[model samples]
Every structure is written in C-alpha cells, then in structure tokens.
Target: MSVPPENLHPRSRLVHDALRAAGILGEIVVLPDAASTAALAAAALGIEVGAIANSLVFWSDDEPLLVMTSGAHRVDTAALAERLGRGRISRASVEQVREATGQAIGGVAPTGHPAPIVTVVDEDLAAFDQIWAAGGTPHTVFPLTYDELVRLTGGTVAKVD
Candidate 1:
C-alpha cells in the first residue's frame, strides 16, 4: 500500500510537489522495504533492471551534473565528458550530493533540487515505455516516461554509456 502524499518524508514531499508542478500524473509509491539500489528497486517492482532510472550526480568542472542512466549499464564518465565537451567527470561526494540535491545519495530524485542542475538523460532509458525513479527517499519511487523525465529535468538526451 502507498502512503498519502502528505504523509511522505519532507524530502519526498518536495519531490511530490515537483512532480505535480511538472504535471506528471504518477503518484509516489512507498515500497515495503528500502530500494536504495537499481537492482533492489527492479526486484521490488518486478520490472527489468534497465527500466530503473538511477539518478547520479557528477562533478564536471567543479559543478554538479545530474546524469540519469539506465540501471543495466555503467556510465562511462570519460566518454560522456568528451561528448559534452566538458572537463573530467567524477562522482559527487555524499556531502556534495546532499548539498546540491537536498537529498541523500541513494534517493536522489531527478527534480526537487535546491537549484537547477545540468542534467543528462540516458538514451537507453527511452527504450522503456515506463521508467521508475527514486522519490527522494529509499522507500519511495514514482513512474515516468522517458520524454516526461527529460522534460521534467530539462535534460539533454544523450548516450551515457
């Protein structure tokens, strides 16, 4: 069973608000257990792991770049940086993740950040009709289409791996 939106964690409530503001119709679903990793989320939802959209933060030229990638593949940061014509891309630290997104590492949502982040949507995610993304908490997730995700995050669609 899913909890009411008002009863969600404060961080999740921010995500819920962001989704509503974006006109996304999907409701956040609170899982029975924490789905911190893509594999765990896929198993919990009984969906293909590739359908899980992992929200990852990377530091590029000392700025935060949000990369939403399919769970089935690892992001090739070097190739991605070259494609973006940016400097080296490195994973953000835990503190940096929270400072930039106002959420923890395992539960970073595409939206609801303290400020706008430069975002990239993996081209592979478009293969799935429905994609699941974290809802600002380990126990929460929401559904979205690849187009909706790109629009929501103002992301550039690219091959991330």
Candidate 2:
C-alpha cells in the first residue's frame, strides 16, 4: 500500500498560504522528498513531464534570476546570459538560493520570494494547459495555469531554455 503524506511542514504550509493569498485556488500535492524532480513528480502524479514547471535559480553576477523552465528542456545559461546582456549565468548555491528566495533548492516557487527577483518563464511551458510547481517544500507542489502563473509571478515569458 502507498503511504499518506505528512502535510505539516512549515515550508509547505507557507506555500499553501502564499498561494491562497495570491488568489491561486488549487489543491496541493505532497510526495516523498525523492519525488521532487520533474520526472519523479510526473511519475508519482501520473502526469506528463511537460506539465512540470521546474523552478531553477541562477546567479547573474551577484543578482538572483529565477527561471521557470519546462521539464522537457535544459536551460542554456550562456544563451540566457547573452539574451539578458548579463556578465554570466550560473547555478546558485544553496546559501545564495536561500538568501535570495527565502526558500530551499527543491521548493522555490515563482512567488513568495524575500524580494522581487527577476523571473523568466520558458515559453515551452506555455504549451501545457496546467503546470505543477514547487510549493516551498520539496514534497509539496501546486497546480496553476500558464497565464495564472505569469500573472501571479509577474514573470516574463521568454525562451530561456
């Protein structure tokens, strides 16, 4: 038999409240920590990988850049830097991520960051009717439409991946 989720984590609860406050009405799905990856999440939810919105954080010089990429593609950091006219683009460290977004590695949602970080949404993600995203916790995720995500996050839709 499958195990039920333990939905008491502070981070997860914060995500729930944040989403609700943003007028994002959707059910939260909690899984094991190992299921945080897009592939793993899709398999556990029995959904297509393309529907997973992978929240990726990058360091553009000293600033934080959030890129919500589709699960089906890999983000080309060099290409993104070129497009943004930035010095460089690289993956953020755990400390950098936490300091910038007030969230951890596997649970960085589009919103609820400590401050307003520049966010870019991959255009490929627009192909999905609905997408799943991290909910401030590795085991938690929430659903949102592409347009809703853009509105809630104030993110620009671009070809980042």
Candidate number achieving the greatest TM-score relative to the actual structure: 1
Best by lDDT, which number? Answer: 1
lDDT per residue as tens, model 2, 32-89: 6546678987887788998888999999978999999998879999988888788899
lDDT of each: 0.95, 0.81
lDDT of 2: 0.81
Stretches > 4 Å off in candidate 2: 1-7
Per-model RMSD to reference = 0.6, 2.9
Let me know the TM-score candidate 1 reaches against the reference structure: 0.98
Off by over 4 Å in 1: none
